[model samples]
Target chain A: MASGRPIQLFRNMTAKIAAIPMILTALVIFVGGTAWTVVYSFTNSKLLPRANFVGLDQYERLWNTNRWIVSIENLLIYGICMLVLSFIIGFVLAALMDQKIRFENTFRTIILYPFALSFIVTGLIWQWLLNPDFGVQNVVRGLGWVSFEFDPLNNSSIVIYGVLIAGLWQGTGLVMVLMLAGLRGIDQEIWKAARVDGIPMWKTYLYIVVPMLRPVFITSIVIIASGIVRVYDLVVAQTAGGPGISSEVPAKYVYDYMFQGQNLGQGFAASTMMLLAVAIVIIPWAYLEFGSRNRG
Target chain B: MANPATISTAVAGADTLPLDGPQGPRPRPRLSRRNIFIYGTMLVVAVYYLLPLYVMIVTSLKGMPEIRLGNIFSPPMEITFEPWVKAWAEACTGLNCDGLSRGFWNSVKITVPSVFLSIAVASVNGYALSNWKFKGADIFFTILIFGAFIPYQVMLYPIVIILREIGLYGSLGGLVIVHVIFGMPIVTLLFRNYFASLPEELFKAARVDGAGFWQIYFQIMLPMSLPIFVVAMIIQVTGIWNDFLFGVVYTKPDTYPMTVQLNNIVNSVQGVKEYNVNMAATILTGLVPLVIYFVSGKLFVRGIAAGAVKG
Candidate 1:
């Protein structure tokens, strides 16, 4: 045993050495990429990167720009609307299905199928359905309701809600799945107890089941929130941030400035701001979740 | 045997008591007007959830003339397979006027290799972290989890730059590499969490039998991980197949994924809006992932639920 110690130690060292490359690659890609972006934010880059440092001018311009401000505000509205709407709709659907409804799998599939499609396709379908001249609105008008005026796509003020509808359709399926999983995990004895106590179904769901599913709810919220921050494809595919950029979100704004507007510095600055914002929100939540898990 | 007889006697007594039994219903019928009202409301809600898909199907079948007539719910006046055929054969995506059919091979090419490599690397990493217990394993896992939360949009610019420097900016290989990198976090987290959940006694037994790390991982752990492995493959396959941004950014025109073709075809500003063709193309682009989702729905849900509940 004493003689074997040296050989075992050598084997352990060799294993550690083997893992070094994997660890280093992950660190380099994440750390190196983050550093590169932060540095480029300060440079006078355009289309392609040029190495001239430009101090804080890009930051200054980003803050003062009206489009940037609007985009930020729009993202806040879009994010909140999408999150709240998807959550409520998903929860209700999951609850209904959990009631042992007929065609449970079929209904679940119909709801989840939208999630399988790319946002690009869903956005296009939505755009078509909402178009003023050739969509549902015109059809409604053709039914002799001359007073109907459903044209959110053309209305700069309310168009983001139109986009939010499409987003909700795609996202609610994921929320439903998460909630359904949570619901299925609940003990049947709890339901029996609740029923014996003369508790109604809705009241039981609201008080007992939903509270039990809090962790799942939080997980769903985090996933949906991530999608909100990265909501570019839908905007591009549907509105192209049109009707005078009323529906513009920060990601689209950054893409435009980076590629189309030829202002990489400003774009990178905006990206930095986005990163900072996400970190601010996520870091604390992650700490709570991960920290609590580890400590226990 | 005595306990069983006593339980049966108790059940017989409860059944004979009927209304006085512990499982007896309320004095009056509980489900009244309010219950019917609630069920009615739920049914309407279900209809609302299903309406858009109904419209998409109806519209896809309608020709331009019927579509222009603007009856979303009505059956098509002249239902035809023309649009589906046109979308597959003749739709104009760009300077290349051919349909989205051209991108089918490209998507398969990118998705197959990317899925295999990502899953393989993730399995290796998961094995190392779970079994090896190196000094920095916790820190490495923490960073990887954090990486999962960072929006892919924020990483795009930097990734593009890195790819360009490495001479992979506009190649199909580059896109595959990017997919693997982005796919790593979730895949690694999944397998690592799964492997951690497994019986440590098995590993101890394997070690006592003179098994090395690779031997245990390959012969013991990996075989036990088939269910989670299927789930991981489904997620990666669907994600990579339906990817739009990476496909658009990293791939040359010759290698555009079906999504990019669908996007260009449906999103052209100056071209006439061909709703039929666009719908057909959308359906086509969505076909593979949809099929996967349907077939693997149960496994996918189980896998995600297990991972989420444990983590």
Candidate 2:
């Protein structure tokens, strides 16, 4: 035991001290805060945290409320469409860019520039662009298509799609960049082998290369899916869940309830639902992604 | 990795064999049908991406009457910078008509300190985790990384409560902390991966010289990890600048960041809509990150790839 000078508690003292914020956040805020929100969702608190248990009242109310139901439905539609379309569009773009095209740098910079702008800007731009009288509709009408109906912001049933246009415009570029990275990561020898075999490029890409890019696909899905889950700001900035709350999303619902309405229990329940939805998507994927990490 | 010269050489090889002799005089048109298709599609998509920006620029430059009259696709018939001037100096948010400059300065205040502090924490934490090997460091790191997935809405109220309890809820400083907390997982993941990917010999050599943890971090790790720090700064500066939810939720009305202020100014329901001013404000709000994006170029791509691949 006397072999050592001393085993002080502060041996890596700087590290332990430096890590206090991360440790506190990981523990107190992330874990503890999420658990607290879940627990408080069961309470009847209004405007402040309280301990009065209210059982499933909040949950039932949340489900029964047309706004909340609409939020979930919109989330589903947006989530599915954004996920599928972004992947397809992104992959196709990446494939095209991978075709040894000229002006690759220019195309990449132009396409990816939107990823730089905030959602607020994207929403505002799209909002003006979609304005019924003076936006794309009016411009097209002036160009002699007076019967054109390109207005999506003003339509309730299709307002989510309106938000979708902005979201896709803002998002797909990042997906393409990620996919391009994936495509570039692939070995060219595979392409050479396919060429030597007289296999068509499309067939080679579909059969051999697509399967090879599974990890990249998974990574893209995770990024896009998470963005879909947190699809509040786009909706807020674009539509403000307008046309009678038609494009309302759960994140917006939770925010509105908690802050504007001061309905804490309702907001908590809605957010708990949001967390649950993310968990549903993330858990299985995380299992496959990280679960494989351990074994690999 | 194939340079232009190599690609042309390969094409020249293919070209000489089939259509003409190896010394054929004429070169085929570079715009083959396939090249046309690829470039055409990319050009269209690029235009689709550039449309909003073009509209923003010209729309902001035109007079309000001209904006109302002219098509968004057309360049301004007569350009004016009045909107830009007004948006910067006199655009009203409630009783304050001092324009987005306040919000701009506020965002600068928030973003600079937050970026520096977040990088500082992440670099140290990453160095410690990679080299020091504390007993339970990885466990906490795992939790923190996974914690990034938790919806910000859930933690919003709790953070408000915490900050309020500490008497910093509505302050800009409070928002800085909020950004750091949210930015931690990605930034840390970034710095950690970069640090971990460094040659093990460097760390070992430093330790062999009796360099303690702080000494090594400040002396060896920080200097060597400059690129990663820039990536982190790129990520945080754009991210914090673009953040609307936290800006709205955490800051007071006047103290709101540019994104929040722009939203209020443009989307305000009271006054008659100033289309040109609104466009100018939107562009101004977007300019910080846009400038950074254009300036940073490939580093921005590397930054995102780092976050994505590692996350």
What candidate 1 gets wrong by more than 4 Å, as runs, is A1-25, A195-203, B1-42, B303-311
TM-score, model 1 to reference: 0.91
| Model 2 Cα interface RMS deviation (Å) | 0.9
lDDT of 1 by residue, A1-296 (tens): 77986776565564466455456546766666666777889998987877789899889999899889889888999999898989998888788778765567777777777887788878887998898887778888888997799998889999999899899888788888889988988998898789889999889988998889988888888778877988888888889897898999898877788767988888888888888877876877788787998899
What TM-score does candidate 2 get on C-alpha atoms?
A: 0.95
**lDDT minimum window of 10 residues, candidate 2 chain A:** A1-10
Return the interface RMSD of the candidates, in order shown, one decimal each: 2.5, 0.9
Please report, in order, the local distance difference test score of every candidate based on alpha carbons: 0.80, 0.90
lDDT of 1 at B81: 87
True contacts kept of each: 0.42, 0.73
Residues B31-71, model 1: lDDT tens digits: 66755654676667667667766777777888898887657
Q: Which pairs clash inside model 2? A: none
